[model samples]
Target: MHPSLTIRRENGDMVKDMPRVKLALVIDDSRVVRKVARRILEDLDFEVAEAGDGAEGLAWCRTEMPDAVLLDWNMPVMDGLEFLQRLRQEPGGDAPRVVFCSVENDLDRVRSALDAGADEYIMKPFDGDIVASKLTLAGVL
Candidate 1:
């Protein structure tokens, strides 16, 4: 589910007057990569979800409805490009801005990702500033 920022009362009801947190998903095979991305997004004030692969990420997208996604290019089960293709076809999928984050710096690959519906692209070895910048450009931050 999309992560919540609501305050709960003593009886477990939501406390009024607080704004909901925006959700972001980090999809990559590497645990280290996911962890790094999660930390960056969280620092940007986003509630982050992580997936080990494209397939799992897509499954989460079909349900949770996050505000943004940081997707990797190479992964098991489903690659990032294939996942992007499938995600665009799913209901409400187009609503979340997708940022393709990978080591693949080839222009053609980047173009393909944009053509397939990615809102932005980030080269790997990205820092928190880069993540925040891309998310901002994509209107996710």
Candidate 2:
């Protein structure tokens, strides 16, 4: 049985009870980045969604808001900062914890993202441990 599932007996048969699955969105222009983040989030028991840019991400959120977001700082169509701003304006948008994942490590840039309503920041080339730690701190784990 998966860690997220509970095994039980029902009428002499085994049943797997699944707990409420958390949803996570990975918004980045890079397909590789999205795939990597999705793997980590899935391993953490979250159902993951992907969007190529901030515009697409926001559109997805409007339809089905996620519990957490892994956003890229830079992308065409709309940047992470703009998406964060717009997302906050949407109903139930404030509920998702947003984490900016990017290659930018400048202090000022980090501050700007935090000010724009990002819950945390993760430098790119991130591994599972780094992502897990950041998500845990952001109260998503």
Candidate 3:
């Protein structure tokens, strides 16, 4: 299931009329990860959207034009690298800042994500405060 659907069902009221809160899209395969991310962003007053994989994530990006994107590196469909490439190619694509959230800790992978246009990177098992700090540094928070 898409994380957005779950979030909409669970926190529908909080999702409404939040214009001051910037829009963000969280793309990951794990529901637990999405829940944690949602909790953190909502606490910070971000209007959050979510997707289960990179393909869905890319689609959402095109349609919603979110202010920022939290993307997982590994997914069953259209992994993060491809999605990032496609996103950068879209018209007015440079508006949304992207941050990679993944378990892959390899320095090379981190470099690749940055080269692919990720403004920042966060490893898995992340603390909410740490993620928030990174987002702030990336100018998303």
Candidate 3, superposed: residue stretches over 4 Å from native: 1-9, 12-18
Cα lDDT tens digits, model 2, 1-110, are 12453322213554344566677889999998988888888889887778999999999898778889999988999999999999999999899999999999998999
After TM-score superposition, what is the CA distance of residue 113 in candidate 1 from its true location, in Å?
0.7
Best-matching candidate per TM-score? 3
> Which digits, one per residue and each the tens of the lDDT, describe model 3 over residues 1-141?
123432243535544333344777889999999989988887887768889998898888766677788889889978988888899998867788898999999999999999989999998879888888889989978
Flag regions of model 1 displaced more than 4 Å: 1-18
TM-score of 2: 0.86
Residues 68-131, candidate 1, lDDT per residue (tens digit)? 9999999999999998899989888889999999999999989999999999999998999999
Each candidate: RMSD: 4.7, 7.1, 4.5
Q: Which sequence of candidate numbers ranks them by TM-score, best first? A: 3, 1, 2
- In terms of lDDT, the poorest run of 10 residues in model 3 is 1-10
In Å, residue 115's CA in model 2 sits off its true spot by 0.7
